[model samples]
Target: MKRSKTSKSWMNEHVSDIFVRQAQSDGYRSRAAYKLIEANEKFKLLEKGMVVVDLGAAPGSWCQVINNAIGSQGKIFALDLLEMHPIKNVDFIQGDFRDELVLHELENKLNDLKVDLVISDMAPNISGIKTKDQAGIIHLNELALDFAINWMKPNGNFLVKSFIGEQYESFIEAARVVFTRVTTFKPKSSRDRSAEIFIVGQKIKNIEQLNDFGLE
Candidate 1:
């Protein structure tokens, strides 16, 4: 079957993206790696010996970035509904993050250690429905926030991909109550026409305080 014009255009753009070319040269799995790298550069999130979680980690790009940034001393637990090729120094959990069993497995991996950082690059399969896509992004962001509240250290940081529509402002406001600092970041690797932005929440004080913030 012939590809639609839109699909062909998207393919062309994806093939020619500078980040994509750079990823190939740098031995990264995907261009998405640069997004995390750029965000970390801005927020100073990743560090040596820190425990981190990568939610919705597929194709292992973000996992690769985290592993490289944190080095061998740090540990990374990555989860995704889709199968991801294994990356060195990352514990890969293949399952839906929303499932209780998967969540339990993640907690088990922690083994009493609080996470230093939680990064989520989850996005729903685009359906060409803007409102639905936006809602899906918001829902994933909420889930990532919940994980941060439950599993993160007092000063842990969270970086999540969110769409800038509908719940965007309210979500940032809600994040502020749990985190001492909250900011939205759009990396240069992110396409200019894309609505996606990274929300960085830092210094989570107490999980109980999240209830007051209404993100629980």
Candidate 2:
């Protein structure tokens, strides 16, 4: 089958990307690993013995970062819609994490331990329609935020992939309502042309302070 021009261009660019070459040399699964590495450096988000959750964790690059950063005593629970080859010290659940059943499976794996950090590199399937794609991206962002609020320990951190578009500011504001501190970042490894950004929410607010963080 012939590849489209767009795909060919993407492939060529991907091949030439510095992060991709670096990841290959560093034995990381994908270039995405650098994004997390950069974020952790800036935020000090990881530490030994932390319980971390990685959503949309397939291809396992971010999990690789978590596994290395958190070390032996730390726990990593990863989930995705696609199958991921196993990584040491990482427990992977393959399913649509948005579904209640899949969420239950993840919860069961955690065994009641509140997560120290929740990182989602999730993105919805692109429909190529601007509004629809943005909506789907925002929906996943909201779901990831909700999951972190429900599952993370107080002072826990939430880092998620988000796209800049309609409702983007409101989404950031919603994060502010639930978390004591919220900030956004564009990792150096992130493509300049991409609208995607990472939102970091530190320390879930006290229960009394959180109202509707669901873009209400």
Candidate 3:
């Protein structure tokens, strides 16, 4: 089968991408690992022995990064709708985290450990239909945030990938309401042409208080 020009162009660019080459040489599962590394550099989000939850963690590059950053003492509860090959220290749950059974299994694995960071690299499979893709990503972002609020340690952090769109500011505002500090930036590993940006929420406000205000 003949490849579309777009697919051929993308393959060429991906092959030449510095991050891609580095990921291949560095034993990271994918180029996405650098995004988490850069975010951590700026936010000081990861620390040795801290507990974490990773959403949409297929391919496990971010999981590898987390495992290295936090070490053996740290715990990682990771979930995705897709299967991920095992990473030595990552506790992976392969299922839709939205399902009650899946969530229960993840919680069971967590064993009530308070998560110091909740990071999501989750993005919906793009169908090239702008409206549908945007809605799907937004829903995933919301679910990640809600799960973070319930599971995070006091002053824990939340980071998620997002794309620029009509509802973007509203989501930022929503995160700000839950976290004392909220900011968004594009990591160096993210493609310049991509609209993707990461939202970081630091020093969470009291979850109980958020519930009292119905913010949760």
Question: How does each model score on lDDT?
Answer: 0.88, 0.91, 0.90
Kindly provide the TM-score of model 1 when superposed on the true structure, using C-alpha atoms.
Answer: 0.92
Report the C-alpha lDDT of model 3 over 53-161, residue by residue, as the tens digit: 9999999999999989899999888899999998888889999866889888988887768899999988988998888888888888888898888888899999999
Worst 10 contiguous positions by lDDT, candidate 3:
207-216
Ranking by lDDT: 2, 3, 1
Q: Report the Cα lDDT for candidate 3.
A: 0.90
lDDT of 1 by residue, 67-162 (tens): 887899999999999998888888989998878898899889888988999989999988989899988889889888888888888799999999
Selected candidate, larger lDDT, 1 vs 2: 2
Lowest-lDDT window of 10 residues in candidate 2?
207-216
Q: Candidate 3, 70: how far from true, in Å?
A: 0.5
What local lDDT score does residue 167 receive in model 1, on the 0 to 100 scale? 85
In TM-score terms, candidate 2 sits at: 0.94
Tens-digit lDDT track of model 2 for 150-184: 88887899999999899889999988888889999
Give the poorly placed runs of model 1, Cα more than 4 Å off.
1-4, 207-216
